[model samples]
Target chain A: MNATEPKPTEEILESLADAKSVFIVGCSGCPVGCDVGGEKWVDEMTAAVRGAGKDVTGSALIELLCNKALVGIKLGRIVEQVTAAEAVLVGSCGVGVQAVGNMVARRTVPALNTICLGDYQGLWPGEERCGECGECVLAYTGGLCPITLCAKSLVNGQCGGTGDNGECEVSPDHPCGWKKIYDRLKELGRIDDMRRMIDPRDARKRAIPDAIRRTTRYALEVSEQEDPAPASEE
Target chain B: MSKLQQQLEAGKFVVTGEIGPPKGTNIEPVLHEAEEYLKDNVAAVNVTDIQTAVMRLGSMALCHMLIDRGIEPVFQMVCRDRNRLALQSDLLSAAALGIENVLALTGDHVVMGDHVQATPVFDLDSVGLLAAISNLEAGTDMGLDIKGNPNKLDGVPKFFKGCCTTPCSPTPEAQMIKLEKKVASGAQFVQTQAVYDPGAFENFMKMIEHIKVPVLVGIVLLKSAGMGKYMNRSVPGVQVPDQIIQRLTDAPKEDRAKVSVEIAAEIIRQVRPICQGAHLMTLGWDHCVPGIIKQANLT
Candidate 1:
């Protein structure tokens, strides 16, 4: 997640506005492990809402909503607990929230404004390490994700705002991502990779649209069962 | 009695302040700032060790510098970069320097620092560190053996050990258990994390009334509304009420500092009865602490 991006303040405020009984759901996926929205976050948000003079019905943390089996088990219990609540506040990433919405009744409200898929790393409180662009270019940049680093997210060239200190004009504390990519390349003795011009990123491929389906072996089994057999005619 | 013990026994409204040392060898500014607090006659001046996971001058060395300047220093020992041997050695060094007061803490993780490559040595957690301190005070090392034939300096070095507790913990039961462990490990005084809401602190204090040690409520001067929100989101067990944030937001740019001082002073004024005293974490704004103390009528 973008640590600098304003936290789920607005989402939390909006979630508790007209709701008395609230159920908080935490995500145990990417952002959660990095300290954004996990079991600790769920407890913190619950206390915050409760301190605001509202009754929190109950709270549950799902391990990974992307996993069908785990989601099925956890979401079943979550739906039951939140059944009596007026609203549900999910503290997961955007994808996790969409998955939960698919399984649950259409009343749960998302309390977290899911930012980017990344790690927050810096001396100061707010610094994100990764920005999950669908394309992977770590092979050229010495394992450093340049898509997240470059100020303009430029894949080919450096931004015009790079200063002597490698900091972007937009923010002095933040290093120009492209400059870091160049430095890392030089350090790894692979400066020749910098000469390779990159093309524009395909937005369609990068866009993580909601409700994605995975064609597992179970799908193949279902399709085989759907086919008419000679034994069925007998 | 030690100076801190004497001060506490006299029923004095103890005033302790924090000093964030600089990173480089240019220690003039740090010493100057520390002297400023010392000149104010604060009961004790705490020299922080690796605050916010950023490396700086060692707390033991800085505390020694303060002691040499005739100022009582409370050396903060965090279990982040040092192993048990180093921790024990540092504690022994502090005792050797006659620096009695210590604040034990489980330091921030390496991921939170600018130097992520640096290895984090969490040989012993805060609880274990506290136990080590207690053992040191009992004239034994971590191996439970007497040091130098057990007759060194008439007895074991007595330390006015302190540990931190967060009043804004999600569960008071767990927080109390941790606090009790600290107390059981020989914490003479408990310094809480930044406390913004009096109601929350009151509830936490009520839950831990059985612990007999004095609880020093941490009073952090709120810098800005954004800062309040940042702390609320990033740091666990630190909840800044929206009203406080709004108060900061409404203040003019130049008056923000004064407004923060007033807010901290007001919190201290209200919480003095419940807590022994306030541990002021000025967050590099030490000059305003005197003003806060004055405004709060804390003698």
Candidate 2:
């Protein structure tokens, strides 16, 4: 679950100060789990906005505010309110806030800071377990992410700070991440896996505005009907 | 730094030694080194915590053994693995087990040794580890709560903590920042990485003249030119000069040990006045240290 908390009432009002009318957007996914930006929070925000003297032209509890295509469709259903509003206030995480903004031409301001992806089954559920870096190294680490587990996030080697008790030399609360790997690999009888030096994370893969347009049946059908490259052009 | 600290505080040049514990349950190597060398000149012997990030016996357990054998074991704690919970408890455990001196280090990375796939936890660096020791000593945990929260009281554990630095770093200025930070974080004294170049060390000493802590210069006994060249290439921040490597290469195979001892003694004699003392790391050549000490007149 994505977690979020409501921004301070005063700060929200200050951001919405210049607008007489505004649109509120919340996520049904992550923000709802944290109770920071779901339907009730949107209702409470509407009341807070009414009290603060701004008109709530419209509000949306998007199924996934991060889905730009769905957002565009939902946004099309209420074009009038959106046109009437001077600005939009997003009550979800950073991704949600940006998603709504991408679908709208008007100014979009975030009302909630993007926390982290969380598990639903309550196994370290609400905390950020994975940083979701573009590359993943959990397979070699016995399902433990060295990038997220280790404190330094060193990709190649461990700093020799580990104590002998399989305890971390840094924080006393966490176990030595490498020791866990060692024991796991030892048990699996694959202690040689520890010698594999994971390559540095490729930054370009994580770069934003990147896209992957998967092959679809429609494209396949269109390609079937289309002629091959012209002989002269080829 | 407990015994060594007192000695340093008294303006006396104090020496300390280090021992790497055996991989399996063999206790003889550890005790033999302590009984052999630490009985006389060395103020304290540091029980390494998996030196080079390789698997080994626990430093705390070895410290307890050293204590049982009537030796002063400096319980070296590295931040590379343990978090505060383990570190704090180990501090209490060490004190309870009659272990006093503690050395803080940001251990070598796990990839350097036999275990390459190990997940390292360098939650705290060297300075952070030293600060953790201080936090534990102040009758509180890392979160600043009383040692035993919501329970009966126990005596506070006190430690004479020390930290390591690389004075001959490629960038000595940055090393000074760490040195000063370690001192600021309550490091009683400072031990350095292996020092082969005295000019660089004197330059380092000149830069950090105001730290006010005793600096125990690191002196490793180089057995051959191959060892010197390998150290210069493999070890982090340790640069063995070309002249020293050439000297080692020129020595006959039979005279290699003699040349190594002579070089170690000469380096000690050169750096002795500048540093508070030398922390000799034998690296399994404990027998050769006597020659180095004798030649340098440290006996």
Candidate 3:
């Protein structure tokens, strides 16, 4: 599930300032779990928008706003209110906001900023995300993924640039990822696990772009059994 | 073996110097500084690669130039601007140019440099780069041939491979862990980030005693009191103690260089008992290397 955080209040209000009426769309999936978007957030946002002196066209909490078909059906149920609004305020992750934009002709504005799940976690529990690098070294790192947590994504170990305060050299705000991994491994009594030398990541393994497609082994087996192609001669 | 490697192997407390290639084509001044001050004073002079990720003349080119001047150059290679193919090719190029010493670094982030918008290419971290160098030494490359075998090099070149560490990092355990990995990956020696506190450096040296690679503690000359304070605030893993900052502040403007050399020599004297050597990074003040070496009695 994608993580999300609320955008600044002033930014959201300013984007919707030109509209006479605003409808709010909240996701009940990941954002709801994150406590930034849900039925409660939708109600709060509607009240806030109304307080800003705009007509409230109503709000709906759609399940899995990332699913276009589901979002379309949910918006269809409130067609009258949706059509009456000049702009839709989406209180979900970037994917959910884009889904609402695709489904409606009205100006869709996002109310939340989609933070990189890789860089953030202590802010919310269980916020770690898999980068799908195709090769996992979680065991060696005591379940901490340096590829995602480290600012430079250094797979071997920490760079020498770690700050004196255990902050990343890139910025004082970011904690050193290897330090966390070191602490975790120490707690697990697996300090020697870090000694295992990991090879450089194969670029081919992560060459998959926006979409990853997989051919099922069942289909491949069935096809091979049904029609075997002639072998080519060298 | 390179002179630095030979000296380390002989149990000599060797000292290395450093020089940053100029931002433009006019490299005479820096090269002259190296020849004038560092040529006979230090074992080898390090030519930084886009030091701090700020773009400048390439390290390889400057390193080749150093060879012509009869100066031993430690070609500092960072994995921030090249992919695996380019890195391997450059390693071969460096060898072809008679560059014996190579320092592998993950490098500082690009955002810290002048060109904030430039992209950083950490295709291989320091450990991986070291492994690659080892592979090259073994007469093979880090690639598979058409027959799915390690590609063979026509005439493999060897180097005195070195890596860097921050002895004063707040995460000392983590830094040690990484250093252990670097040594495991084939790091022959280490030239560390600037170290000011000899006590911290001693502690770090004791912690890394298991790793047999020679470690050269780094010392960057403090040009002024303001630079010391700025380093404390901005330079990661480098903590210039308040007393040293006060020393720089108390020094008269004309005597700042003398005081800076004294501070550097003092740190070297303190750490010389515990470590293999010292790496003097004078920034633009290359003329101070001889004075520091003399004061530290490294000769």
- Most accurate candidate by TM-score: 3
Query: Superposing every Cα of model 3 onto the true structure, what RMSD results?
Result: 16.4
- In the range B1-299, model 3's lDDT, one tens digit per residue, is 89999999999998999999889999999888988999989899999999988889989998899889998999999988898999999999999999999999998889888998887788899999999999999999999999999999999999999999998988787788888888888899999999999999999999999999899999999899999999999898899999999998998899999999999999999889898999999998988988999999987
How big a share of the true inter-chain contacts is recovered in candidate 2?
Answer: 0.06
Pick by lDDT: 2 or 3, better one = 3
Which candidate leads the pack in DockQ? 3
CA shift of B60, model 2, Å: 1.6
- Residue B195 of model 2: what lDDT? 89
Q: List the residue pairs that clash in candidate 1.
A: A149-A177, A150-A177
Stretch of 10 with least lDDT, candidate 1 chain B: B144-153
State which candidate, 1 or 2, has the greater TM-score: 2
How displaced is residue B256 in candidate 2, in Å? 1.3
Ranked candidates (TM-score, high to low): 3, 2, 1
Off by over 4 Å in 1: A1-234, B144-155
> Residues A189-220, candidate 3, lDDT per residue (tens digit)?
66776777888987654553222123253245
Chain A TM-score, prediction 1 = 0.45
TM-score per model over all chains: 0.56, 0.61, 0.73
Per-residue CA lDDT of model 2 for B97-140, tens digit only, reads: 98888998877777666787887766566666777777777766
Off by over 4 Å in 3: A1-126, A209-234
